[model samples]
Target: MYRTSWSCQSRFVIHRTLVAYRTKGMPVPRPRLMLAVILFAQFVIPLSISGTAVALPEIASTLGASPTPLQWVVNGFNVAFAVCTIVWGVCSDRIGYTRSFQIGIVIAALGGVLSTFATNIALLDTGRVIAGIGSAAVLTGAAPILSHLFHGADRAKAFALFGTINGLGLAAGPALSGLLMSAWGWRGIFAAHTIVLLLALVGSMRLPLLGRANTSLRQILDFSALKAPKFLTMTLVPMAGAIGFVTFLTYLPSALGAIHSLAAGATGALMLIMTIPVLIAPVLVHRVLERTRITPTGIVAASFACLILGGVGVLMLLRPDLPVALGVAPMILLGLGFGLPLGIVDAEALAAVPAERAGAASGVINLFRIGSEAVFVALFAVILATVVTTALPGRSGQLVASGEHGHPWIYHDGLLAAGITMIGIVIVLGIVFFALTRAVSRTPALGEQLGEQ
Candidate 1:
C-alpha cells in the first residue's frame, strides 16, 4: 500500500514538472502563438477585400463619388495587391520574413487609419491601394514563414488551418461588415481593420526568428524555379480553383437572380450551403491525410475530379425547367473541389522549390492565384455577355450580364456556354496537372536538389 502511494505521488510530480517546463519554456509555444498571429492577420486581409464591397453604396452616398471613382475603390486595391505581391516576395527574402511581415502590418494599419477618416473618394481609394500593397506582403510573407517554421505533416496542417481561416474571412466578411455598418457606419469597417492589424503587429514580435536569404541577386532573380514542371503544376492547381470555382462564385448571384429570381437576402442565405463546405473541407482533408496513406498526388487528383463533376452538375442551374434546390448539391461539390486542395497545394508548391527561394515562390504562386481570380472573373463575364449578345443583342444582353430583368432563355444559353467553356479549361488543366505530378515524382534530381536545400 505504501509503495503504490509513492508511485502515484512520483507520477504527479513528473506531470507537474513537464507542465511547468512547457509554460516557462516560451511565452505560449512559438508555433501556436505565431500561427495565431499569422491566421489573424490573414483573416482580415480577405475580410477587407470582400467586406468592402458591402460598403460601396454607403461610400458613394457619403462621398458623392461617381461610378468610375467608385469602381476604383475596389480595383485600385486589387491592382496594387497583384503588383506588389511579387515585389514583397522578393523583398521578404532580402530583408527577412518576420521583418517584412511586421512592416506590412504597419503599412496596412496606416492605410486602414487613412481610410477610416478620409473625407474624399480619392483619399479612400489611395488608402485602399496602400492597404492592398501591405496585404500583398502578408500573403507572401506568411507562407514562407510557415514553410520554414513547420516541416512535413505539421506544415500541411498549419497551411490547412491557414486556408480555412482565409475561407472563413471571405465567407464571413460581408455579413460582419454589414453588422458593423449598421452599428458604427461605413468607417467602422476600416477602423476595425486598423485595430486588428495593430494587435497583429504586436503579436508578430513573438514570431520565431529566421534569417534572410544569403543568395546573390542573380540567384534571387533566377527564373529557374518557375521552369520546374512540378512547381508550375502546383502553382496551376490554385489557378484551376480560381477559374473553375471562384469565377462561378463571383458570378453565381447574378445567375441566381436572372435565372431563378432569388431575392438578395435569400441568395445570401443559400450561398451558405455552398460556403459551409469550404470552411470545413480543409479540416476534412487534413483528417484524410492523417488517417490514410493517400499520396499528395492522389489528393490532387481527387480534388480535380470533384471540380469537374461539380462543373457538370452546375449546368442544372442554367436550366430554368430545373428546381433551384437541385443546384445546391453541385454548389457544395464545387466548394469541396476548391477547398480540398487549398492548403495542400501551397505546401506542395513550396516543397517543389528550394528552401532558399520559398519566399519568391510563394509570391509567384499567390500572383497566379490572385491574378487569375481577377483576370478570369472579368474574362468569364465578358464571355457570358458576348454569348448573350449573339442571341439577344444590345440592351437585353447587357441586362442579362448584370442580372437585371432580361430574356430568361437567352441568359440561360449564355451561362451554359460559359460554364461549358470553364469546364473545358479545368479538364485541360487536370491533364496537365497529372502529367506534371507524375514527372515530379519520377525526377530524382529534383528531389535531391530540394533535399540539399
Candidate 2:
C-alpha cells in the first residue's frame, strides 16, 4: 500500500511538471472571443481594397485625377500592404499581437483622415500609401495574434474562420464600394474607412490578451524563424497562387464587360458566383477533408490544375455565345484554383513556423505575393491601356467625353494579354508545383504523375 501510494504521488508530480512546461508562454489555453474579433479585423483590410476598386471612377472624378494615375489609388494601399507585412510580423512576435494590432488601427486612421484633404493625385496616393502601411501592419499581425487563441483543432478552426472572413471581405468589397459610393461619394468612402479603423481600434483594445504580457517590438517580428522549408513553400506557392489569381481578377471584370455587357449589379453577381465556391471550400475542408491524411503538396498540385483549367475556361469565354452566364463557368474553376491554394498555403504557412513567429512567416509570404501583385497589376493595366488607346470608339463613346475607344478585334489587346498571361502562369505553376511537390515527398512517385491524370 505504501509503495503504490508513493508511486501514484510521483506520477502526479511528473504530470503536473509536464503541464507547467507546456504552458510556459501560453497564458490562457484559448480565447475564442478574441479570435472572433481578430477575424473581424481581418475583414477590414481587403474591405478597403475591394471597396476602393468599385469606387475608382468616383474617386478619379472627385479628385480630378485622370484615368492613368488613378490606378495609384488602388496601388498605393496594396504597395504598403505588401511591404509592411514582413516588418509587422517580426514586430508582433517581439511586442504582442494585441498591441501591434492596435498600433496598426491607429496608423490606418491617420492615413484615412489625411487622404480626405488631398488636393492632387500625389497627395491622395500618399495618403493611400500611408493607409496601406497601416493596413499591412494590421494584416501582418492578425494570424500571429490569433495563434495563442487556438491550437490543434481549435487552431485549424480559427484559420478557417480567418480565411473565410478574408474571402468574404474581398468578395464584398465591390458591392460595399457601390453602396458607399452611391450614398456618400469619394469623401464618404474615406470617412467610412476612418470609422472602420476607429471601430476596429476600440474593439481591438477590448480583446483580452490571453494573459500575454509581452510588449516588445521583438514580439512583432523575429528573423531567425524563417529557415524552415515548409515556410519557404508557404511563401512561394501563395505568391504563385496570387500571381495566377491577380492575372484573372485583373482582366475578368473587363472580359465580362466586353462579352456580356454586364452592368454593375451583374458584375457583383458574377463575383458572388466565383466567391461562393471559395467560402464553401473552407467549410468542407474542415468538416470533410480534415478527416483524411492529405499532403499540402497534393492540394497545391490540384490548385495548379485548377488555375490551368480556369485560365483555359476564361479563354473559352471569348467565344461569341458563352452559353452559360458571363464568367460563371470560368470563375467556378478559377475560384477553385485560387481558393484551395490560398486555403492550404496560408494555413500551412502559419503551422510551419513556431506560433511565436507565424506573423513573420505571414509577412515573408506577403512580400512575395505583394511583389507579384505589383508586377501583375501593372502588367494588367498596361494591357488595358493598350487596348483602350488603340481601339476604335463605339457609338456610345461618341456620346461620352471620357469613354475610350475599345479594341475592335475579338480578344483584342487587353483580353488577349489576359489570355496569354494566364496560360503562361498555368505552365509556370505546372512546372514549379510538380517540381516542388516531388521535392517534399519521399519519392517522386508519391507526387502526382504529370499527364497521368
Candidate 3:
C-alpha cells in the first residue's frame, strides 16, 4: 500500500513539473517540426489559389464549361473560404487548434479527391467549395498556433517566414501546376494537392495541443473591430489588393495563351516573372518599415501608389500595337506594387485587436479579402462575356474557340474592357485609402480609443 502511494505521488510531482515548465516559457518541444508542419499546411492554400490559374483553360476545354462557369471554379472556392473562415476560427477556439487543423486536412483531401475524379463542372465546383472551407479552417487555426509557439523577435521572424512562404506558394503555384499539367494533365494538380495535404496532416499529429480562449460564441462573433478606422483601412487595403491579385492569377494565363498562343508551361513561366517579386519584396518592405517607423497608413499609401502603377500597366496591355516584350514589363511593376504590402497588412490589422481575439480578427480581414476576390472575379467574367458575346454576335463557335485557338484580336476587345474596369477599381480604392489616412492623421488617438473599447 505504501509503495503504490509513493508511486502516485511521484507521478503527480512530475506532472506538476511539466506544467510549470510550459507555463514558465520553456521552448516548445520540437519547435522546428511544428513550424514545418504549419508552413506546409499554409503553403497548400495559396498553391491551390494560383495553381488553378494555369489549369483553368484546360478545365474549360475538358468540361465544356463557359468562361463564367470557369470563373466559378475559382470563385466558388473563394466564396466558401470567405464565409467559413470566421466560423472555423471560432470553432478552433472551441474545439482546439490541432483537432480542427487535422479535420480540415481530411476534408480538404476528400474535396481534392472528388475534384480529381470529377467528370462535370458542377461536381468540380462542389469539390472546390468543400476544399476551400477546409483550407479556411487550416489557415484560421494556424495564425494563433503560430502566435502561441513563438514570441518577440522569434514571432516577427515566424510571421515574416509565413509571408515569404505564402508568396512562394503564390509565385510557384502556377509554374508548378503548368509543369504537372503538361506532364500528367489537369487532374494531376488536384492529385498533388491531396498528397501534400495528407503529408502535412500526418506531420501535424505530433504538434502539442494548445489551450483555448475562454470566450463564448457571441464574443468570438463580435466584429466591433470594423468600427475602428485603422482596422477598417487595413482590411479594405487587402480587399483592394485582392482584386488585382485575383484578376492577375485567374485570367492572365488564359489571356496570355489566347493572345500569344503560348503553351501552358510557358505561360506559367511568364507568370513567375510577375510573382517572383512577391517573394522578395515582403522581407525588404518589412525591414524598411521597421527602420522608418512608418505608420500603417503611410505603408498603405505607398502600396496604393504601386497599385496605381500596376493598373496603368494593365491598361497598357490593351494597346493593339505594343510589342509583347514591352507589354510584359508592366507586370513587373504590378508585382512590385502588390508584393511590397503583402506581409505587413495582416500583421498590422491583427495588432489592433487584443491577443485573445486574434483568430476572429484574422477571419474578418480575410473574409473581406477573399469575398472581394470572388465578387470581382465573377464581375470580371461577366464583363468579358458581355463584351465577347456582343462583339462576336452569331459566332458561338468562335466564342467557344476563343479560349484556345482563336485569333489574338478575338479576345482583345473583351480584355480591354475588363482591364479598364480593374483600373477604375484601383482608382476608387486609392481615393478611399488616402481619405482614411487623412482622417486618422487629423485625430491621432481615434484608432487607439476605438480599439480600447
Candidate 4:
C-alpha cells in the first residue's frame, strides 16, 4: 500500500510539470533575448546611414547623380526619420511595442527592396524616405520597450548596452559596406539590409506583446516638455553632436577621395579611427556616472567639452599639406565626444517627464536630434556647392558631373568651409553649455523639476 501511494504521487508531479511546460501563456522573455531583439533592430538604422554614406560615390556614378541630388539620398532618410519618430512613438503607446516593432521591420524591408532595385535617383530617394520612416518606428519603440522590460539599475545597464550596440553599428557600418561594395557593389549593401531586417522581424515574434499605454494623440504631440529649460538644454547636446557627426560622415569619403586620393575601402578604414571610440566610451561613461554620481546636466557639459576639442581637430583638416594619418587623428576626439553623452541624453530626457509620457518625450528629443542632422546635411551640402561654384567658376557643373574624380580643389575648398562652419557650431554649443550651467546654479529647484517624474 505504501509503494502504490508513492508511485501515484510521482506520476502526479510529472503530470503537473508537463502541463506547465505546455501551457499557452505569455512567457517571460529572457533578458538577453529581449536585448538581442532590440539591439538588432537598433543596428539597422545607423548601418543604413553610415553604410550608404560610404557607397555614395559609387551610387552617384551608377545613377548619374550630382552632389546635391546625392545629398538628398542621405537627407531624404533623415527628413522622414525626423517627421515619423513622433508618429511611431504615439503608435507604440496605442497599439503595442511588439506590433509596432514588427510593422517597422516590414516597412524597412520593403524600402530596402525598393532601394536595391532602384534604377533612378528619384526612386532611390523614395526608398530611403520609406526606410527612414521605418527607422523612426523602430528607434522610437525601443526605449519604452526596454523601459518596460528592465527596472531601476537594470534599466540603466540596459541603456548602456543599447549605446554600445548602437555605437558598434555606427562604427562597423562604413567598414562593412566598403567590403560589400568591393565584393558585390553598392546594391549588395541594400540587399544585406533587407535580409537582416527580415531575420529581426522573425526574432521579434518571440517577444511578449507588451500592454499599450492610454496616451492620446494630443498628449503625445504636446510640446510642453520643451518649456522645461533643463530638458531643452539636455536635448541640444545630442542635436549639436548629430550635426557635427553627420556632416563629417556625409562628406568625409568624398573629401578623402578628392583631396587625399584614398579609395572607398581606405576611407572606411580611416573612419574606424573616428568610430571605434564610440563603441568603447559608453561603458566607461556609465561606470563614471555610477561611481561618481554625477548629475546628467554636468555630464552633458563634459561631453560638450569633448565635442569642442573634436571640432578643433576637424579644423585641422583644413591644412591641405597635413598628412592623411594626422588629418584623420581628430576622429578619436569626435568619437569620444559623440559617444559619451549618447546613453545619458535619452535617459536624462525621459527622467524629466512623467513615466506615462516617456514615449512622447523621446519622440521630441529625437526629432531635434535627427531633424538637426537632416537640416545640417543640407546646409553642409550647400556650403560645399557654394564654395565649389565660387572657386571653380563655370566648371562647377563639370566638376560635379565628373563622378568620383572631381577637381581636387573643390573638395579642398569645401573642407575648408566645413571646418569654419563646424568651429562656429562649437562656439554656439559652448555658449549654450555655459548658459545651462548658470541656469542650474541659479535654480536649485531645477533638479526637483527634472526629477519630478
Best by TM-score: 3
- Each model's Cα RMSD: 7.6, 8.4, 6.7, 7.3
**Clashing residue pairs found in predicted model 1:** none
Worst 10 residues of 1 by lDDT: 1-10
What is the lDDT, from 0 to 100, of the residue 7 in candidate 4?
34
When 2 and 4 are scored with lDDT, the better candidate is 4
lDDT of 1 by residue, 26-118 (tens): 543345667799988887776765556556546755874354455456656666777787788778888787788888889988999999999
Lowest lDDT sum, 10 consecutive residues, model 3, at 1-10
Question: In candidate 4, which residue ranges exceed 4 Å CA deviation?
Answer: 1-28, 91-94, 214-225, 283-302, 318-320, 343-367, 389-403, 450-453
**Winner of 1 and 2 under lDDT:** 1
> Which is the leading candidate under lDDT?
1
Q: Provide the TM-score for each candidate, comma-separated.
A: 0.71, 0.73, 0.83, 0.82
Candidate 1: segments with Cα more than 4 A from true spot: 1-31, 48-71, 90-99, 113-124, 144-160, 171-192, 205-211, 215-223, 253-265, 286-295, 315-323, 347-367, 378-421, 438-442, 449-453
* Rank ordering of all candidates by TM-score, starting from the highest: 3, 4, 2, 1
Residue 301's lDDT in candidate 3: 77
Q: For all candidates, what are the clash counts? A: 0, 16, 0, 0
Candidate 3 segments exceeding 4 Å error: 1-29, 147-160, 210-212, 217-222, 286-299, 318-321, 350-363, 393-402, 444-447, 450-452
Worst ten-residue run, lDDT, model 4?
A: 1-10
